[model samples]
Target: MSKDLRESEAASLDNEVLSLLGRHVSVRKFRPDPVSEEQLEAIIQAAQMASTSSNVQAYSVIAVTDPALKSELAALAGNQAYVAECPVFLVWCADLYRLREAAKPHLGGAATYEDSAENFIIATVDTALAAQNAAVAAESLGLGIVYIGGLRNKIAEVAERLGLPELVYPLFGMCLGYPDQSPALRPRLPLPAVLHRDRYDAGETVRQVKAYDATMSEYLRKRTGGAKDTPWSAIMADRLAEPIRLHMKDFLQGKGFLRR
Candidate 1:
């Protein structure tokens, strides 16, 4: 990313892919224009090509374009209007149900969650990689997208909505369409703060964070036209003060993950 683009001192390598990725900003407000079927298929193909753990490809995506369904999902996802308004909403799932079926004949039974932690992590990681590929593909095609992790807020309801079988869990939802609003790129912490010299160090952590917080505060101020000026730490702390999806353990267990 160019310094002119990010307006940050974060070290960046100049390249086609990095330039594309570095300029990314989540698109919340989208135009009502429809994303073409051809574009959607191409994006999915890109997603399908992402690497999977152990070649398991243990994930699936549900494309929801039904207005009624989207409306319900919008409510389920904390009433985020974009969930319903976007031209396409996709639910990415961490899936093992298909694997169970594929392996059933050889094992003479469905696969159990004996390696629950490992399997669960693999599926989640696979799903995220696939979704990111799709997001980048969409951006390349001149579309906009926003990831909706809030889908987890009503996990059971989302499962019901999508008729998701056991061994499948909604990781997140994504809204895609033509962008209606252009948002400023969010700043990131400087490279030295995150990149280590092959060893762990926290000596500069506080200093880097304080400086980054000032940058974030300024960004927020300009972005909101002075309506919001909360610092990054305060905002994150407030978010962390809320439940970190306490139901996740039981829910994933019930969905046949993390049983061990």
Candidate 2:
């Protein structure tokens, strides 16, 4: 590549990364092309490079390529067919079980003492950061990815299917493959609504959200052939309004994560 071409490529790569920042859209449709082994290796390496709290590295990733497992996972995750169809389904876990077991001697035969909310928080954060890095890397490689937060909807069932031990929580699942369809970028909260200077400013939050609702509604209509006219706020409110809300406390207790 010539110097000018190199410079142009560098600028384009920068734009690609930034585009991922805002233009990132969850791709549910994917081509039949399998993600290459080299690409998968690079993505995992990027994930491992993510910072961990106190270097504890409290995270584990399970790559599911087995058709049976993917089908089970898809059913457990609210029948998300894409999870089964995608070439790769990565399950990211907030894992402290290994460390907790490893520190058994330090706990004087009561390793249970080390299991606390603070530990859970650290593991979850570490896992989330690592997973986001993997997602970004996959995006950079001309691949499509979607976060399956629904994986937590039935935590116990998912854990049982995967045969997970205690102290290990499934944070989320990720679907990865080549894109068969290109969807428009999902609208985000306007900058002023979320990017506070120092402390959080809620002064114009409501107004900004109202404006965003209008913008997103139009986008949705155009995309969905005027079928669904849902606004962001309404969708969020509905999600928060349920009482039992697909209870997960029992499952979490079983998994040994002391949310208390």
Candidate 3:
């Protein structure tokens, strides 16, 4: 293709992808319709294609479809009803167990680094990337999804219920199904606040964040019909003040992760 034609095609593709990503909204309310097996397979295939560190692909996904199991998980996830109501609940896990098992025969009892902090980081990042890819694929298929971070509220019990072995831990859960409601998109931090040029610019970040606070405040006010107008910074401050998920460090260590 000519240079101009190639550039045109690239821009067109970029526009399509950007449009799909820019409209992202978490759907808490879902329709009664069930997600098909074919759709689920396609989503997982897309997730598997996500980039991984050194191609370790140290992640696993569990799709919970049984009503009873979903109900149990819903309770474990702090009573998030959508966890049970959705057609599919996917538990994304940061897993080193598979890799360890695969290498055991070849190692001849040699020491392994699967328990190192660096490996923990890699597994966590790999799981997140794969899950995001699945999320995007589901959205493209006219399905809606909501991530259930509350799955970590009772991580140990959740892991036990799923029968996860050593070197594996649940990172998060996702509820997937057809949408029953259309919620407004949540506002995000301004691009300038997150994207720095060459070196970190604290002053510019502060200024951009202040501007974003105003944007979020308006969004909250409208969303709640004037019931809330809290700025982004104040909300984040509250989050920091709370001792949220304080058990994570100990829990991860108990799971044989992050030893180093």
Candidate 4:
């Protein structure tokens, strides 16, 4: 975190908010220091405090500390070395299996709600919200984290490895530890481009987007020494243009999450 980047926090809001928000940096490099048991407990306590739908708490987190398991998970998740190296790797799951079973007999020995996409969506949203809360808490405690969305690459294998029953799907993984190096803060879109008034507005979207691209390009140039460079739009376009296996539909289907 350089002086300019640190001060860029003011570009968003007041110094207090900037201090908190600016602490977020996706740490790929980590020191060998292990996160203490007490710190881990506090992080989880913060997660448990997050709001849940109907207070059903349809989510669970699995902390992976076994070296062999972490290595295997790293291989499954695009071979991201950080997964294997981190002291803690947490898998956040959209878990409805326990609740579904408990409600089965009460729902005339069948599912309380029809197995459908809507149910899956609810669980997914709940899990995501809870995981984000945990991530914020970890960062606030001086711990670094990187979300491993790539864990979806081999979703079924991961679920099986974790011994997850049907209706419990791995939503995402978070790698955690003491950061070895602090990466630069990535630029974000200007407020007007994303925030809208009463009705939706794209009037200034194009101009704001172009400006953001310029900001990102400049940031990357200074950070990467022009070795690898890309504008935000270009990166997004390339990713979306390709036939990426967002194989989430099939994964959910296999888990019997949205049978309808």
lDDT of 2 by residue, 1-260 (tens): 35465567674656545766766789998887898889998999999999999998899999998989999999988999999989999999999888887777777755364357788789999999999999999988889999998898887788878878888889899999998888887778898998878787778777799988888899889989999778989988987886632567667666777656
lDDT of 4 by residue, 88-130 (tens): 9999999889888777777865436536887888888888888
Off by over 4 Å in 2: 1-14, 105-113, 243-245
Cα lDDT over the full model 2: 0.85
Q: Which ten residues in a row have the lowest lDDT in candidate 3?
A: 1-10
Candidate 1 C-alpha lDDT tens digits along 1-260: 46355445346577556878998999999899999999999999999999999899999999999999999999999999999999999999999999887887888664466338999999999999999999999998889999999999999999987999989999999999999988888889988789878787789765688888898889988988899988888998999998878998899898889987
- Candidate 2: residue 227 Cα off by (Å): 2.8
Candidate 4 stretches with Cα past 4 Å from truth are 1-18
As a TM-score, model 1 comes out at 0.91
Sort by TM-score, best first. Answer: 3, 1, 4, 2
Best by lDDT: 3
lDDT of each: 0.90, 0.85, 0.94, 0.86
**Would you list the clashing residue pairs of candidate 2?**
none
Pairs of residues clashing in candidate 4: none
* lDDT, model 2, position 147: 97
Error of 3 at 120 (Å): 0.2
lDDT of 3 by residue, 153-259 (tens): 99999999999999999999999999999999998888988899999999998999888989999999999999999999999999999998899999999999988
Best by TM-score: 3
TM match of model 2 to true structure: 0.89
